[model samples]
Target: MIFTLRPYQQEAVDATLSHFRRHRTPAVIVLPTGAGKSLVIAELARVARGRVLVLAHVKELVAQNHAKYCALGLEADIFAAGLKRKESQGKVVFGSVQSVARNLDAFQEEFSLLIVDECHRIGDDEDSQYQQILTHLSKVNPHLRLLGLTATPFRLGKGWIYQFHYHGMVRGNDNALFRDCIYELPLRYMIKHGYLTPPERLDMPVVQYDFSRLQAQSNGLFSEADLNRELKKQQRITPHIISQIMEFAQTRKGVMIFAATVEHAKEIVGLLPADDAALITGDTPGPERDALIDNFKAQRFRYLVNVSVLTTGFDAPHVDLIAILRPTESVSLYQQIVGRGLRLAPGKTDC
Candidate 1:
């Protein structure tokens, strides 16, 4: 191995191997953000017999995981369209779900083990890309062992990702993708052990938007339209929030602002220094988005205001301050957002 696995990370891999030895059912390994899940995935793939396939929701993660696996002096293929590479015939393949779902015939029963990074994105929808690929691949390879790694194990509306959690007895979901959480590394444990930066919540903002009147859908999240309407009713709320964020960011190295919407992100960017801040929404073009993210990591900018894009699969260890201007009732979503700043970096004390 090129890099030594941390104690908890090796434990996670051991738990996974043990689970597969005892049962054929799918299992999950819950590791918080910045806990080096990619390394664990690499080690697991390295040890697994037969071909392996690693799935990620976005191209960023597809590339990230592929790089980690390669760092072991091992060979693997990448099958993500966004990265403009699609080589499926290899001992190990890292692929984006969209590209793989569209071309399942190339992979047909070839893999013995499948690893999904950020598996919580696999929803209950049977027709979803992830489900479609899983159904097709499992049909061809009945002995295929499935493993998932995620920071947040629960979905916003759908409770848990697995039928059982090792942490404790939890509510069950028959439709959950994985059968059990074979292992988990707690956020508090990582913080106490100095593996991650501790998160400290700031005082309540002087101005707060009233979301009480908004009703949640069956999915347990307010509709985007409703959130925008409610936010509009709060007079000068965005301005006040941005002002407070700027005040707090003065002492931080890197600041990330989670905006409620695209327009909201733009407004926040407008309030920040034009040269020191950048906005990234789902609509940003691919090349421009990549450049913006690269610049932010290089410290060319101080504040990065994004809308629902940087929650997962983004790595910038220098980020120490995270301003959540968006309101969410989902614990999983909130945790994923805050986890962005919890990575350890030089000269960084806490998030």
Candidate 2:
């Protein structure tokens, strides 16, 4: 099947090509959460002269991107061990960073273009898996070009990916991963164009903990373990919050509740309507998680509680109500959480 891009998406592709021609360096494309990034990636692979490697942080994204390529009549191979796939010399390869990080040497083929999905995750740390893989690949393919795609381009403390510079050490004042942002589709533009649902922040307070006392981690965010412990103390108060959420989202069709930890998620599920609510976390088995997500998407459940699972690649347009039970300082995390409900639905005027 032939695929077509929206006007802005095509423009983004054109801008990326022009930047590469002029500067010959890595570039990033900042598109909204619901924007068709995979389409731009597909078009890139279609026009590429050599092999293309699409790197995603999660298996879900790797599969999602590969599926889009396949629908567009592109032959793609998966490099994720979790999916039981091996590296191949396919023209297009969808790779999970976690799976391929350890086996970079296994992929002997030198790719001409490296498209990083959710590329904002490439941190400043030189020893990070992303940097490690790139460092190794640079020697093999000196002329390899990078194309980063992300909704949020800035890190917690690293400023923007384009201006990321690490000082003090062996690699002081190092070059950033991307030369510049070639294209940016702002959230306001997407909302104004009716491509995404306009979010309405509910004033209901979900947690009642002394967040000020929580110590921050290196990323300038509260430690997950500490936050979870604090959240656990509020388990007894979840039923009240659930009741308030139910009242606030009375007319909404689907509700997604984000929690700090698996135990907190379980507590939320216990408080919610047992027959209409489900919980999923990183620990949940793959089959069970998929089933829960499928059920939630099918509208079998009015509420779905999750912990660090349903943030990015998961799409549920009917989720008009988002109860952010988990508080996060990371702009990317906040965007992803709110973005779960940003896809435009038939009657979804407010998110």
Candidate 3:
């Protein structure tokens, strides 16, 4: 299949090429979720002569990226754990930082380009697989170009978008390593673009938020160093809370409930409107996990309750109700989940 890039996406590709011509160094492109960032990167991989290293963080995301680029006529290989590289000398390689961060000696400097997905995590500090990647690249492929892509470009601690300017990550920065690829498509923009449907949402209406008990548990009323023991006890009472959500979302189509733990996910599944709910996590085996996502996308399931596993790099266009039972401090994650619901439906925006 031939790939036709979007206007902003094409602009990003052109800007990346221009940057490459000038710096011959890796660069970052910040684009919103569902903006077809993968498609752009995939096109780059298709045209790349030498190896192209595409590094994603999660296994699911790694798999998603591998599939996308492979579809672009780029012979892509996966180096994730439990997955082996193909015999095809494929020009594109999708590696998970979790899978290969500690083993850079093997892939170091081998590829001419390094693509970091969800790159707001790269930040100014040195840590995580990102820091490890920079360390390896600086030593091995000092001239190796970096192409970072993310929806939100700021970290949790960075208060303002202006900090991105100072960090030299924003296009506004004079010493910017990579110019802004495109920040035009926020979730709202995606909705206007007909890529996502606006979601229906309500603040979960429970008489109580389990506040006092949570405070007590935190202040040491529990025997465990963890909060699970208390959270589970509290969730047993959540069935009553589910009734409220059911009533509020009764007319809504699909819902995703994000939780803190597997047990929490399980309880959410149980409390869901029944017969149409499922759970997904890192623990779910391959076929089953894939099925859940497929079914969710196919509208076979109306609800999917999961942990942090599904937050990033996951998209179900028909999902029109975002039920956030999960707590988050990161803007990147918050925007990511919200972006999932912003794709415009058929009558509205771009395909």
Clash list (residue pairs), candidate 1: none
lDDT of 3 by residue, 146-254 (tens): 7788787655544322223313443334434444443334566656765556555466555534534443232122232234665666665667666776776566566
Ranking by TM-score: 1, 2, 3
Candidate that would win on lDDT? 1
Each model's lDDT: 0.89, 0.82, 0.67
For every model shown, what is its TM-score relative to the native structure? Answer: 0.96, 0.92, 0.79
Model 1, span 1-351: residue lDDT tens: 579999999999999989989899999999999899999999999999889999999999999999999999998999999999999999999999999999998886568899999888888788999889888888988888899999888876667888887767765578888989999888999999999999988974587667788887765666788877877788487788778888988999999999887767777889999999999999999999999999999999999999989988899999999988777787878888999999999999998
Off by over 4 Å in 1: 167-170
Clashing pairs in 2: none
Q: Which candidate achieves the best TM-score against the true structure?
A: 1
Clashes of each: 0, 0, 14
CA lDDT for candidate 3: 0.67
